[model samples]
Target: MKLKSGCFLQHLHLLLKYTACMSVRNAAALMEHFQLLDVHRKNYLNDLQFYCFLCYVTDLNKDKIMLLFDLLDRNVRGRICFNEFYTVVYTLLSHENDLEKQFIPRHAGRAFQLLDVDRDNMIDFNEFEAKRFLFNIQKEVKKIFKDIGISGDEQLNYREFKIFAVFCIDKQQKEEGDHE
Candidate 1:
Protein backbone atom coordinates (compact mmCIF):
# COMPACT_ATOMS: atom_id res chain seq x y z
CA MET A 1 0.00 0.00 0.00
CA LYS A 2 1.05 3.56 -0.62
CA LEU A 3 0.35 6.77 1.33
CA LYS A 4 0.54 10.47 0.59
CA SER A 5 3.38 12.62 1.83
CA GLY A 6 1.02 14.81 3.85
CA CYS A 7 -0.76 11.86 5.44
CA PHE A 8 2.54 10.13 6.04
CA LEU A 9 3.82 13.28 7.70
CA GLN A 10 0.71 13.45 9.79
CA HIS A 11 1.04 9.84 10.86
CA LEU A 12 4.70 10.32 11.59
CA HIS A 13 3.94 13.28 13.79
CA LEU A 14 1.32 11.35 15.69
CA LEU A 15 3.75 8.48 16.23
CA LEU A 16 6.40 10.82 17.59
CA LYS A 17 3.94 12.30 20.03
CA TYR A 18 2.79 8.86 21.15
CA THR A 19 6.36 7.74 21.74
CA ALA A 20 7.07 10.80 23.85
CA CYS A 21 4.65 9.52 26.49
CA MET A 22 5.29 5.81 26.40
CA SER A 23 8.24 3.61 27.37
CA VAL A 24 9.08 0.40 25.58
CA ARG A 25 8.54 -1.74 28.67
CA ASN A 26 5.29 0.01 29.39
CA ALA A 27 4.07 -0.45 25.88
CA ALA A 28 4.92 -4.14 25.97
CA ALA A 29 3.16 -4.61 29.26
CA LEU A 30 0.14 -2.80 27.93
CA MET A 31 -0.09 -5.16 25.01
CA GLU A 32 -0.01 -8.09 27.39
CA HIS A 33 -2.37 -6.50 29.87
CA PHE A 34 -4.89 -5.80 27.18
CA GLN A 35 -4.87 -9.43 26.14
CA LEU A 36 -4.15 -8.43 22.56
CA LEU A 37 -2.61 -11.83 22.02
CA ASP A 38 -5.84 -13.59 22.86
CA VAL A 39 -7.67 -11.25 20.59
CA HIS A 40 -5.38 -12.36 17.80
CA ARG A 41 -5.28 -16.00 18.73
CA LYS A 42 -7.44 -17.05 15.82
CA ASN A 43 -5.18 -15.47 13.26
CA TYR A 44 -2.11 -15.82 15.43
CA LEU A 45 -1.25 -12.22 14.58
CA ASN A 46 -1.67 -12.81 10.87
CA ASP A 47 -4.58 -10.42 10.96
CA LEU A 48 -5.29 -6.73 10.85
CA GLN A 49 -6.15 -6.36 14.54
CA PHE A 50 -2.56 -6.86 15.54
CA TYR A 51 -1.56 -3.99 13.33
CA CYS A 52 -4.43 -1.97 14.71
CA PHE A 53 -3.01 -2.41 18.20
CA LEU A 54 0.29 -1.03 17.03
CA CYS A 55 -1.40 1.89 15.35
CA TYR A 56 -3.48 2.46 18.45
CA VAL A 57 -0.38 2.61 20.64
CA THR A 58 1.71 4.65 18.22
CA ASP A 59 -1.12 7.01 17.27
CA LEU A 60 -0.60 6.16 13.64
CA ASN A 61 -3.45 6.39 11.21
CA LYS A 62 -5.51 3.23 11.00
CA ASP A 63 -4.68 2.95 7.30
CA LYS A 64 -0.95 2.63 7.99
CA ILE A 65 -1.37 -0.18 10.48
CA MET A 66 -0.44 -2.94 8.06
CA LEU A 67 2.75 -1.17 7.16
CA LEU A 68 3.73 -1.16 10.80
CA PHE A 69 3.07 -4.85 11.07
CA ASP A 70 5.17 -5.57 8.02
CA LEU A 71 8.02 -3.62 9.51
CA LEU A 72 7.74 -5.16 12.93
CA ASP A 73 7.78 -8.71 11.72
CA ARG A 74 9.12 -9.13 8.24
CA ASN A 75 9.35 -12.85 8.85
CA VAL A 76 5.74 -12.95 10.04
CA ARG A 77 6.60 -13.78 13.61
CA GLY A 78 3.47 -14.36 15.67
CA ARG A 79 4.49 -11.95 18.38
CA ILE A 80 6.90 -9.12 19.20
CA CYS A 81 8.48 -8.76 22.61
CA PHE A 82 9.32 -5.49 24.33
CA ASN A 83 12.82 -5.48 22.88
CA GLU A 84 11.66 -5.85 19.29
CA PHE A 85 8.93 -3.32 19.88
CA TYR A 86 11.43 -0.79 21.25
CA THR A 87 13.83 -1.26 18.37
CA VAL A 88 11.10 -0.44 15.88
CA VAL A 89 9.87 2.66 17.71
CA TYR A 90 13.34 4.08 18.38
CA THR A 91 14.34 3.79 14.74
CA LEU A 92 11.34 5.87 13.63
CA LEU A 93 11.58 8.69 16.17
CA SER A 94 15.29 9.07 15.58
CA HIS A 95 14.71 9.90 11.90
CA GLU A 96 11.94 12.45 12.32
CA ASN A 97 12.44 16.18 12.73
CA ASP A 98 10.58 18.61 14.98
CA LEU A 99 7.99 19.27 12.30
CA GLU A 100 7.90 15.65 11.27
CA LYS A 101 7.95 16.85 7.69
CA GLN A 102 11.45 15.74 6.78
CA PHE A 103 13.69 12.76 7.23
CA ILE A 104 17.10 13.80 8.53
CA PRO A 105 20.05 11.87 7.18
CA ARG A 106 22.06 12.70 10.25
CA HIS A 107 19.46 11.12 12.50
CA ALA A 108 19.40 8.13 10.25
CA GLY A 109 23.16 7.99 10.42
CA ARG A 110 23.08 8.12 14.18
CA ALA A 111 20.48 5.35 14.28
CA PHE A 112 22.58 3.26 11.97
CA GLN A 113 25.57 3.83 14.18
CA LEU A 114 23.65 2.66 17.23
CA LEU A 115 22.38 -0.38 15.39
CA ASP A 116 25.92 -1.22 14.38
CA VAL A 117 27.00 -2.00 17.92
CA ASP A 118 30.36 -3.56 16.99
CA ARG A 119 31.50 -0.39 15.19
CA ASP A 120 32.58 -2.58 12.28
CA ASN A 121 30.72 -0.26 9.89
CA MET A 122 28.36 -3.08 8.98
CA ILE A 123 25.17 -4.49 10.48
CA ASP A 124 24.77 -8.20 10.20
CA PHE A 125 21.41 -9.96 10.04
CA ASN A 126 21.78 -10.70 13.73
CA GLU A 127 22.25 -7.04 14.47
CA PHE A 128 19.28 -6.19 12.34
CA GLU A 129 17.15 -8.72 14.24
CA ALA A 130 18.46 -8.01 17.70
CA LYS A 131 15.86 -6.70 20.17
CA ARG A 132 18.30 -5.99 23.00
CA PHE A 133 17.86 -2.22 22.72
CA LEU A 134 14.13 -2.13 23.33
CA PHE A 135 12.96 1.05 25.01
CA ASN A 136 9.43 2.59 24.74
CA ILE A 137 10.39 5.64 22.74
CA GLN A 138 13.00 3.59 20.93
CA LYS A 139 10.39 1.02 19.87
CA GLU A 140 8.10 3.64 18.36
CA VAL A 141 11.03 5.33 16.70
CA LYS A 142 12.23 2.09 15.17
CA LYS A 143 8.72 1.30 13.93
CA ILE A 144 8.67 4.63 12.14
CA PHE A 145 12.00 3.90 10.49
CA LYS A 146 10.89 0.42 9.51
CA ASP A 147 7.81 1.92 7.88
CA ILE A 148 10.31 4.04 5.93
CA GLY A 149 12.25 0.92 4.98
CA ILE A 150 15.79 1.35 6.36
CA SER A 151 17.46 -1.97 5.78
CA GLY A 152 20.99 -2.51 7.02
CA ASP A 153 22.72 -2.38 3.68
CA GLU A 154 26.13 -0.74 3.24
CA GLN A 155 25.32 -0.17 -0.39
CA LEU A 156 22.93 2.64 0.56
CA ASN A 157 25.02 5.72 -0.01
CA TYR A 158 23.84 9.23 0.77
CA ARG A 159 22.13 9.51 -2.58
CA GLU A 160 20.54 6.12 -2.17
CA PHE A 161 19.36 6.96 1.29
CA LYS A 162 17.73 10.13 0.04
CA ILE A 163 16.02 8.23 -2.70
CA PHE A 164 14.80 5.63 -0.26
CA ALA A 165 13.43 8.32 1.99
CA VAL A 166 11.56 9.91 -0.85
CA PHE A 167 10.27 6.57 -1.97
CA CYS A 168 8.97 5.80 1.47
CA ILE A 169 7.28 9.16 1.82
CA ASP A 170 5.73 8.76 -1.59
CA LYS A 171 4.59 5.26 -0.83
CA GLN A 172 2.91 6.42 2.35
CA GLN A 173 1.14 9.18 0.46
CA LYS A 174 -0.13 6.77 -2.12
CA GLU A 175 -1.49 4.47 0.53
CA GLU A 176 -3.33 7.34 2.13
CA GLY A 177 -4.80 8.25 -1.22
CA ASP A 178 -6.11 4.75 -1.72
CA HIS A 179 -7.80 4.88 1.64
CA GLU A 180 -9.41 8.19 0.85
Candidate 2:
Protein backbone atom coordinates (compact mmCIF):
# COMPACT_ATOMS: atom_id res chain seq x y z
CA MET A 1 0.00 0.00 0.00
CA LYS A 2 1.28 3.50 -0.84
CA LEU A 3 1.31 5.30 2.50
CA LYS A 4 2.39 8.53 0.77
CA SER A 5 4.16 10.85 3.25
CA GLY A 6 4.14 8.41 6.19
CA CYS A 7 1.40 10.53 7.76
CA PHE A 8 -0.65 7.43 8.42
CA LEU A 9 2.23 5.90 10.34
CA GLN A 10 2.67 9.01 12.42
CA HIS A 11 -1.06 9.15 13.19
CA LEU A 12 -1.14 5.45 14.02
CA HIS A 13 1.84 5.84 16.33
CA LEU A 14 0.10 8.63 18.18
CA LEU A 15 -3.13 6.62 18.26
CA LEU A 16 -1.52 3.58 19.84
CA LYS A 17 0.53 5.68 22.22
CA TYR A 18 -2.32 7.75 23.57
CA THR A 19 -5.12 5.17 23.72
CA ALA A 20 -3.95 4.34 27.23
CA CYS A 21 -3.12 7.85 28.45
CA MET A 22 -2.04 11.29 27.29
CA SER A 23 1.43 10.74 28.71
CA VAL A 24 4.41 9.92 26.53
CA ARG A 25 5.64 7.50 29.21
CA ASN A 26 2.87 5.13 28.06
CA ALA A 27 4.22 5.23 24.52
CA ALA A 28 5.60 1.73 24.64
CA ALA A 29 2.63 0.30 26.50
CA LEU A 30 0.43 -0.37 23.46
CA MET A 31 3.20 -2.14 21.62
CA GLU A 32 3.95 -4.12 24.74
CA HIS A 33 0.40 -5.48 24.65
CA PHE A 34 1.04 -6.80 21.15
CA GLN A 35 4.46 -8.11 22.19
CA LEU A 36 2.94 -10.09 25.03
CA LEU A 37 1.57 -12.47 22.41
CA ASP A 38 5.07 -12.86 20.94
CA VAL A 39 5.95 -15.65 23.32
CA HIS A 40 8.97 -16.61 21.20
CA ARG A 41 10.05 -12.96 21.05
CA LYS A 42 10.54 -13.16 17.30
CA ASN A 43 9.22 -9.58 16.96
CA TYR A 44 6.40 -10.89 14.79
CA LEU A 45 3.22 -12.86 15.24
CA ASN A 46 2.51 -16.15 13.51
CA ASP A 47 -0.88 -16.94 11.98
CA LEU A 48 -2.16 -18.58 15.14
CA GLN A 49 -1.07 -15.71 17.32
CA PHE A 50 -2.58 -13.23 14.88
CA TYR A 51 -5.87 -15.08 14.89
CA CYS A 52 -5.94 -15.01 18.68
CA PHE A 53 -5.66 -11.23 18.63
CA LEU A 54 -8.37 -10.90 15.98
CA CYS A 55 -10.73 -13.05 18.03
CA TYR A 56 -10.77 -10.47 20.80
CA VAL A 57 -11.25 -7.40 18.60
CA THR A 58 -13.64 -8.53 15.88
CA ASP A 59 -16.87 -10.45 15.71
CA LEU A 60 -15.83 -11.80 12.29
CA ASN A 61 -15.73 -15.59 11.99
CA LYS A 62 -12.65 -17.80 11.71
CA ASP A 63 -12.78 -17.82 7.91
CA LYS A 64 -12.88 -14.05 7.66
CA ILE A 65 -10.13 -13.73 10.22
CA MET A 66 -7.87 -16.07 8.28
CA LEU A 67 -8.61 -14.28 5.03
CA LEU A 68 -7.60 -11.00 6.66
CA PHE A 69 -4.41 -12.58 8.01
CA ASP A 70 -3.50 -13.76 4.55
CA LEU A 71 -4.14 -10.31 3.16
CA LEU A 72 -2.03 -8.62 5.84
CA ASP A 73 0.76 -11.13 5.29
CA ARG A 74 1.14 -9.80 1.73
CA ASN A 75 4.71 -11.06 1.56
CA VAL A 76 3.41 -14.55 2.40
CA ARG A 77 6.16 -14.73 5.02
CA GLY A 78 3.84 -16.49 7.50
CA ARG A 79 4.41 -13.64 9.93
CA ILE A 80 3.15 -10.08 10.45
CA CYS A 81 4.73 -7.03 12.04
CA PHE A 82 3.02 -4.71 14.50
CA ASN A 83 2.35 -2.14 11.77
CA GLU A 84 0.56 -4.69 9.58
CA PHE A 85 -1.50 -5.88 12.52
CA TYR A 86 -2.35 -2.32 13.49
CA THR A 87 -3.41 -1.46 9.93
CA VAL A 88 -5.78 -4.41 9.63
CA VAL A 89 -7.22 -3.90 13.10
CA TYR A 90 -7.70 -0.19 12.53
CA THR A 91 -9.48 -0.79 9.23
CA LEU A 92 -11.74 -3.41 10.69
CA LEU A 93 -12.63 -1.57 13.90
CA SER A 94 -12.50 2.14 13.14
CA HIS A 95 -15.65 3.28 11.34
CA GLU A 96 -18.96 4.89 12.09
CA ASN A 97 -21.85 2.55 12.88
CA ASP A 98 -24.22 4.54 10.69
CA LEU A 99 -22.17 3.73 7.60
CA GLU A 100 -21.16 0.23 8.62
CA LYS A 101 -22.30 -1.38 5.38
CA GLN A 102 -20.69 1.26 3.18
CA PHE A 103 -17.71 1.57 5.59
CA ILE A 104 -18.17 5.33 5.94
CA PRO A 105 -16.33 7.85 3.78
CA ARG A 106 -13.19 7.96 5.93
CA HIS A 107 -12.78 4.18 5.88
CA ALA A 108 -13.50 3.89 2.18
CA GLY A 109 -11.29 6.88 1.46
CA ARG A 110 -8.37 5.24 3.24
CA ALA A 111 -8.92 2.03 1.30
CA PHE A 112 -9.30 3.91 -1.96
CA GLN A 113 -6.10 5.78 -1.30
CA LEU A 114 -4.27 2.52 -0.72
CA LEU A 115 -5.59 0.97 -3.91
CA ASP A 116 -5.11 4.10 -5.98
CA VAL A 117 -1.37 3.59 -6.01
CA ASP A 118 -0.87 5.93 -8.95
CA ARG A 119 -2.77 8.67 -7.14
CA ASP A 120 -5.19 9.02 -10.03
CA ASN A 121 -8.18 9.39 -7.71
CA MET A 122 -9.79 6.66 -9.78
CA ILE A 123 -9.67 2.87 -9.71
CA ASP A 124 -9.42 1.11 -13.03
CA PHE A 125 -9.57 -2.67 -13.45
CA ASN A 126 -5.81 -2.96 -13.07
CA GLU A 127 -5.77 -1.07 -9.80
CA PHE A 128 -8.81 -3.07 -8.72
CA GLU A 129 -7.09 -6.29 -9.74
CA ALA A 130 -3.96 -5.34 -7.81
CA LYS A 131 -6.00 -5.50 -4.61
CA ARG A 132 -8.23 -8.34 -5.74
CA PHE A 133 -7.46 -10.22 -2.56
CA LEU A 134 -9.20 -7.53 -0.57
CA PHE A 135 -12.34 -7.71 -2.71
CA ASN A 136 -12.05 -11.47 -3.40
CA ILE A 137 -12.38 -10.69 -7.10
CA GLN A 138 -10.92 -13.97 -8.25
CA LYS A 139 -13.14 -14.16 -11.36
CA GLU A 140 -16.22 -12.61 -12.89
CA VAL A 141 -14.54 -9.24 -12.69
CA LYS A 142 -16.79 -7.87 -15.40
CA LYS A 143 -19.82 -9.32 -13.71
CA ILE A 144 -19.17 -7.19 -10.67
CA PHE A 145 -19.72 -4.02 -12.67
CA LYS A 146 -22.70 -5.60 -14.31
CA ASP A 147 -24.22 -6.55 -10.98
CA ILE A 148 -23.73 -3.03 -9.74
CA GLY A 149 -25.15 -1.63 -12.97
CA ILE A 150 -22.11 0.50 -13.63
CA SER A 151 -22.10 0.80 -17.37
CA GLY A 152 -20.07 2.97 -19.78
CA ASP A 153 -16.58 3.74 -18.42
CA GLU A 154 -15.41 0.87 -16.23
CA GLN A 155 -13.19 2.95 -13.98
CA LEU A 156 -14.59 3.82 -10.55
CA ASN A 157 -14.49 7.23 -8.93
CA TYR A 158 -14.59 7.53 -5.17
CA ARG A 159 -18.39 7.36 -5.17
CA GLU A 160 -18.40 4.30 -7.40
CA PHE A 161 -15.56 2.81 -5.37
CA LYS A 162 -17.62 3.12 -2.24
CA ILE A 163 -20.39 1.22 -3.99
CA PHE A 164 -17.92 -1.41 -5.08
CA ALA A 165 -16.54 -1.81 -1.58
CA VAL A 166 -20.01 -2.18 -0.16
CA PHE A 167 -20.89 -4.65 -2.89
CA CYS A 168 -17.88 -6.81 -2.12
CA ILE A 169 -18.40 -6.71 1.63
CA ASP A 170 -22.06 -7.60 1.35
CA LYS A 171 -21.36 -10.38 -1.11
CA GLN A 172 -18.68 -11.88 1.11
CA GLN A 173 -20.84 -11.62 4.19
CA LYS A 174 -23.70 -13.31 2.41
CA GLU A 175 -21.47 -16.07 1.11
CA GLU A 176 -20.01 -16.64 4.56
CA GLY A 177 -23.48 -16.74 6.04
CA ASP A 178 -24.50 -19.32 3.46
CA HIS A 179 -21.58 -21.54 4.39
CA GLU A 180 -22.72 -21.45 7.98
Candidate 3:
Protein backbone atom coordinates (compact mmCIF):
# COMPACT_ATOMS: atom_id res chain seq x y z
CA MET A 1 0.00 0.00 0.00
CA LYS A 2 1.18 3.51 -0.84
CA LEU A 3 1.85 5.82 2.11
CA LYS A 4 2.14 9.55 2.45
CA SER A 5 4.82 10.90 4.74
CA GLY A 6 2.32 12.08 7.33
CA CYS A 7 0.59 8.71 7.33
CA PHE A 8 3.93 7.04 7.86
CA LEU A 9 4.69 9.31 10.82
CA GLN A 10 1.35 8.44 12.30
CA HIS A 11 2.19 4.78 11.99
CA LEU A 12 5.37 5.38 13.92
CA HIS A 13 3.39 7.07 16.63
CA LEU A 14 1.11 4.09 16.84
CA LEU A 15 4.02 1.70 17.10
CA LEU A 16 5.46 3.72 19.93
CA LYS A 17 2.44 2.97 22.02
CA TYR A 18 3.52 -0.65 22.29
CA THR A 19 7.20 0.03 22.92
CA ALA A 20 6.91 0.07 26.70
CA CYS A 21 5.47 -3.43 26.77
CA MET A 22 6.91 -5.66 24.08
CA SER A 23 9.99 -7.84 24.33
CA VAL A 24 12.52 -8.24 21.54
CA ARG A 25 11.25 -11.68 20.64
CA ASN A 26 7.76 -10.34 20.66
CA ALA A 27 8.84 -7.53 18.40
CA ALA A 28 10.44 -9.95 15.98
CA ALA A 29 7.29 -11.99 16.08
CA LEU A 30 5.34 -8.85 15.28
CA MET A 31 7.51 -8.36 12.21
CA GLU A 32 6.68 -11.90 11.20
CA HIS A 33 3.02 -11.16 11.74
CA PHE A 34 3.13 -8.45 9.12
CA GLN A 35 4.72 -10.78 6.59
CA LEU A 36 7.84 -8.64 6.49
CA LEU A 37 10.29 -11.42 7.37
CA ASP A 38 11.27 -11.94 3.76
CA VAL A 39 11.07 -8.38 2.66
CA HIS A 40 14.46 -7.87 1.04
CA ARG A 41 15.90 -10.93 2.75
CA LYS A 42 19.61 -10.30 2.27
CA ASN A 43 19.26 -6.65 3.08
CA TYR A 44 17.02 -7.40 6.02
CA LEU A 45 19.61 -9.76 7.44
CA ASN A 46 22.35 -7.24 6.94
CA ASP A 47 20.25 -4.49 8.46
CA LEU A 48 19.35 -6.67 11.42
CA GLN A 49 23.00 -7.46 12.03
CA PHE A 50 24.02 -3.90 11.52
CA TYR A 51 21.35 -2.71 13.90
CA CYS A 52 22.44 -5.24 16.47
CA PHE A 53 25.99 -4.02 16.14
CA LEU A 54 24.82 -0.46 16.59
CA CYS A 55 23.02 -1.42 19.75
CA TYR A 56 26.10 -3.20 20.98
CA VAL A 57 28.37 -0.26 20.29
CA THR A 58 25.91 2.12 21.86
CA ASP A 59 25.44 -0.14 24.85
CA LEU A 60 21.78 -0.60 24.10
CA ASN A 61 20.11 -3.99 24.22
CA LYS A 62 17.60 -5.86 22.11
CA ASP A 63 14.86 -4.35 24.22
CA LYS A 64 16.01 -0.96 23.05
CA ILE A 65 15.86 -2.06 19.46
CA MET A 66 12.40 -3.34 20.12
CA LEU A 67 11.52 0.02 21.61
CA LEU A 68 13.02 1.74 18.61
CA PHE A 69 11.21 -0.53 16.20
CA ASP A 70 7.93 0.16 17.89
CA LEU A 71 8.64 3.84 18.21
CA LEU A 72 9.54 4.06 14.57
CA ASP A 73 6.86 1.80 13.17
CA ARG A 74 4.08 4.32 13.92
CA ASN A 75 1.34 1.99 12.66
CA VAL A 76 2.23 -0.90 14.95
CA ARG A 77 1.31 -3.29 12.18
CA GLY A 78 4.35 -5.39 13.11
CA ARG A 79 6.39 -4.82 9.95
CA ILE A 80 8.15 -1.64 8.93
CA CYS A 81 5.64 -1.64 6.08
CA PHE A 82 6.71 1.70 4.68
CA ASN A 83 9.58 3.76 3.32
CA GLU A 84 9.46 5.79 6.53
CA PHE A 85 11.43 2.95 8.03
CA TYR A 86 14.42 4.26 6.11
CA THR A 87 13.91 7.70 7.56
CA VAL A 88 13.59 6.25 11.04
CA VAL A 89 16.71 4.14 10.65
CA TYR A 90 18.61 7.00 9.12
CA THR A 91 17.58 9.12 12.05
CA LEU A 92 18.55 6.43 14.53
CA LEU A 93 21.81 5.73 12.76
CA SER A 94 22.62 9.41 12.79
CA HIS A 95 24.49 11.00 15.65
CA GLU A 96 22.24 11.42 18.66
CA ASN A 97 23.13 15.09 18.90
CA ASP A 98 22.46 15.84 15.27
CA LEU A 99 19.42 13.63 15.27
CA GLU A 100 17.17 16.41 16.49
CA LYS A 101 18.56 18.96 14.11
CA GLN A 102 19.15 16.79 11.09
CA PHE A 103 16.62 14.03 11.27
CA ILE A 104 13.59 15.82 12.56
CA PRO A 105 10.44 15.90 10.50
CA ARG A 106 11.37 19.11 8.76
CA HIS A 107 14.84 17.91 7.85
CA ALA A 108 13.54 14.51 6.90
CA GLY A 109 11.17 16.25 4.55
CA ARG A 110 14.09 17.96 2.90
CA ALA A 111 16.02 14.71 2.65
CA PHE A 112 13.03 13.08 1.03
CA GLN A 113 12.71 15.92 -1.38
CA LEU A 114 16.31 15.54 -2.40
CA LEU A 115 15.95 11.79 -2.89
CA ASP A 116 12.63 11.83 -4.64
CA VAL A 117 14.02 11.93 -8.17
CA ASP A 118 10.61 12.22 -9.77
CA ARG A 119 9.14 14.62 -7.18
CA ASP A 120 6.38 12.16 -6.54
CA ASN A 121 6.28 13.05 -2.84
CA MET A 122 6.64 9.38 -1.95
CA ILE A 123 9.29 6.73 -2.16
CA ASP A 124 7.99 3.43 -3.42
CA PHE A 125 8.69 0.32 -1.35
CA ASN A 126 11.01 -0.92 -4.09
CA GLU A 127 13.00 2.28 -3.82
CA PHE A 128 12.98 1.96 -0.06
CA GLU A 129 14.56 -1.51 -0.21
CA ALA A 130 17.88 -1.55 1.59
CA LYS A 131 19.89 -2.43 -1.51
CA ARG A 132 18.55 0.51 -3.46
CA PHE A 133 19.01 2.83 -0.49
CA LEU A 134 22.58 1.57 -0.13
CA PHE A 135 23.23 2.45 -3.75
CA ASN A 136 22.19 5.99 -2.95
CA ILE A 137 24.13 5.92 0.27
CA GLN A 138 27.22 4.86 -1.68
CA LYS A 139 27.13 8.09 -3.61
CA GLU A 140 27.22 9.98 -0.34
CA VAL A 141 29.90 7.63 0.91
CA LYS A 142 32.09 8.41 -2.10
CA LYS A 143 32.00 12.08 -1.26
CA ILE A 144 32.90 11.40 2.35
CA PHE A 145 35.71 9.11 1.25
CA LYS A 146 37.18 11.83 -0.95
CA ASP A 147 37.19 14.19 1.99
CA ILE A 148 38.96 11.61 4.17
CA GLY A 149 41.70 10.62 1.71
CA ILE A 150 40.07 7.26 1.19
CA SER A 151 39.53 5.91 -2.29
CA GLY A 152 36.95 3.70 -3.92
CA ASP A 153 39.45 0.85 -3.68
CA GLU A 154 39.36 1.31 0.08
CA GLN A 155 35.84 0.02 0.13
CA LEU A 156 34.45 -0.82 3.54
CA ASN A 157 33.93 -4.51 4.17
CA TYR A 158 30.70 -5.49 5.91
CA ARG A 159 32.17 -5.24 9.38
CA GLU A 160 33.93 -2.02 8.47
CA PHE A 161 30.79 -0.60 6.98
CA LYS A 162 28.85 -1.34 10.14
CA ILE A 163 31.49 0.40 12.20
CA PHE A 164 31.67 3.27 9.79
CA ALA A 165 27.94 3.75 9.93
CA VAL A 166 28.10 3.95 13.69
CA PHE A 167 31.04 6.31 13.46
CA CYS A 168 29.19 8.59 11.13
CA ILE A 169 26.24 8.59 13.45
CA ASP A 170 28.51 9.42 16.35
CA LYS A 171 30.20 12.16 14.38
CA GLN A 172 26.90 13.74 13.57
CA GLN A 173 25.96 13.55 17.20
CA LYS A 174 29.22 15.21 18.14
CA GLU A 175 28.64 17.99 15.68
CA GLU A 176 25.20 18.49 17.07
CA GLY A 177 26.57 18.51 20.57
CA ASP A 178 29.06 21.16 19.60
CA HIS A 179 26.29 23.30 18.27
CA GLU A 180 24.45 23.14 21.54
After TM-score superposition, what is the CA distance of residue 53 in candidate 3 from its true location, in Å?
28
Clashes of 3: 6
The per-model lDDT (C-alpha) reads 0.44, 0.59, 0.39
Span of 10 residues, lowest total lDDT, candidate 3: 8-17
Candidate 3 structure quality by residue, lDDT tens digits, 1-180: 112333212232212322222245544543553344344653233336435433533444565555545444444455544244444434433322223332333344434433334445444333323222322232234444333323344443333333444454456557658999
Question: How high is each candidate's TM-score?
Answer: 0.32, 0.48, 0.29
lDDT assessment of candidate 1: 0.44
lDDT of 2 by residue, 1-180 (tens): 112243322233223312411134333554776789799899899999988776665455678677667656767799988877655644433331112353334457757766776677777877777565443334446568545536557778888878877776577657768999
Query: Positional deviation of 83 in candidate 2, in angstroms?
Result: 0.7
lDDT at position 60, candidate 1: 51
Name the regions of candidate 3 deviating beyond 4 angstroms: 1-152
Error of 2 at 99 (Å): 8.4
Shift of residue 17 alpha carbon in model 2, Å? 18
Ordered by TM-score, highest first, the candidates read 2, 1, 3
Instruction: Please say which candidate is ahead in lDDT: 2 or 3.
Output: 2
Off by over 4 Å in 1: 1-31, 34-44, 77-82, 88-180
Model 2: residues with Cα > 4 Å off, grouped in runs: 1-27, 96-180
